[model samples]
Target chain A: MTLKEIKELLQAEVICGDHHLGTEIILAGGSDLMSDVLAFGKPGLLLLTGLTNLQSVRTADIIEAKAIIYVRGKKPDDQTIKLAAEKNIPLLSTPLMMYEACGLLYQAGIPGVSPANNSNKAND
Target chain B: MTRDDEFRQTFKIKGRDFSHAGGVSTEIKEILQEIGIPTQLIRRVAIASYEAEMNVVMYAQQGKLILSINPETIQIEVEDKGQGIKDIELAMQEGYSTATEEMREMGFGAGMGLPNIKKNSHVFLITSTPGVGTYLKMIFYLDHEKAS
Candidate 1:
């Protein structure tokens, strides 16, 4: 779905990358741990997290995530906004918590980044 | 362009510096983008490099990252001075982490660093001495026809 639709659906505030609201996002992943995101996230992901650190923006950029949706009324600091702007990664803030945000997106037809197939496991 | 066309760059990483942990990887990604590498290859390289950077930041006193980019391959060598893994085998396990509260606060240290790096890299090599440090060399093969 287009980020524009996500913004409207979640009543999210666009903190940056207003010009790139039309960017399409194929999958969504919500996590507070940057490690998990790095391990599992892929390109064109929409990341939802409550962590408001600059690392969040950095993680999204590294994974080539389309945008970041800050959940639970969480907001990113100026540095995060500057980095997101520089990377052309859109930032959105929503009052809903992580679970709710992810649920809304899932119910709206967005799939998670990956399944429980455990394909990422070395043993599997 | 072929393997003859290669670019090399080095970046320094300081430990426990959460503020700028991923700076080197970000710079590398920008460089790859400017060089017109494929998006998928860039993402893989960036992710692996960033994970290595974080490992250095969270565990070492300092580190050096060398990025070698050829027309058909991208390789990164990360060497760090700090408490190295006593058991490389255990460290490679997916859920084994020695991270502290401070490291966790930065949204990292989930014990997924090495595995994730290996997953993203086409070639992964690592070595460490318990008290000395660690070295990681990761490479990504670029598809000539696929890369823009």
Candidate 2:
């Protein structure tokens, strides 16, 4: 699904990367643990998380995640916003809880980035 | 440093700061990439170095991560005189960890740190003295040195 559709599905406001709304995303993962996500994530995946911290953006940058969705309307602090802007990690804040947000995305044909198939893909 | 023969850089890890835990590894990864190291090897070294350094911060009580960067290889040596590990054999097992709740809350208490270091290093060694300290050495080669 396109990032634009994901933004609408979760009722999320695009904090950055508005021009890249047409970017396609296939797999998604939801977790608040930055280390867990870092330990088991593929590049270009979408991360749905409730944790609003600098480390969250840092984790996304380390893994090169496509986007970070802040579930439950938990907007990050200003410093984090600046970091996200710098990293170009397209941030989205949503009112839906983690499970519901993931489910909606899954039903909309956006699948989880399962580890079995998480072998690295070209960033192209 | 994952290049085959470029240059060398060294870093001294400070074990007290939790916020600065991954600093050395990040620097190493950046240097390796800029030195024309392959992404795969760089990632492996980064993971190993980061995990080893975190272990020192969380468990060793205090230590330093000495990173040696050369054109042909990357070596990470963790040396400390802190409370040494009591059981090396048991510690190497997956799912075994001594990390406290605070460390877990930071998202790294999953007991994968040691296993992670061993898995990524082309050469690994650990030595410890109960009353003295612990030392870990790891090496990852960037070149096909066997042919040389």
Say which candidate scores most in lDDT.
1
Candidate lDDT values, in order: 0.88, 0.76
Per-model TM-score (chain A alone): 0.91, 0.89
Model 2 lDDT per residue over A1-124, tens place = 8999999988999876687788889778898765567566667789999877666776676666889999998888887788778768888989999999999987886666554544423222
**Which residues of candidate 2, in runs, are more than 4 Å off?**
A14-22, A77-83, A115-124, B1-6, B60-62, B130-133, B144-148
RMSD score of candidate 1 (Å): 4.4
Candidate 1, A1-124: lDDT as tens digits: 8999999999999998899999887778899999899888877789999899999999998988889999988898898899889888999999998888898988887878676734322222
Per-model TM values vs. the true structure? 0.90, 0.79
TM-score, structure 2 vs. true: 0.79
Cα displacement (angstroms), candidate 2, residue B73, comes to: 2.0
| Residue pairs that clash (backbone atoms under 3 angstroms), model 2 | B3-B71, B4-B71, B4-B72, B5-B71, B6-B71
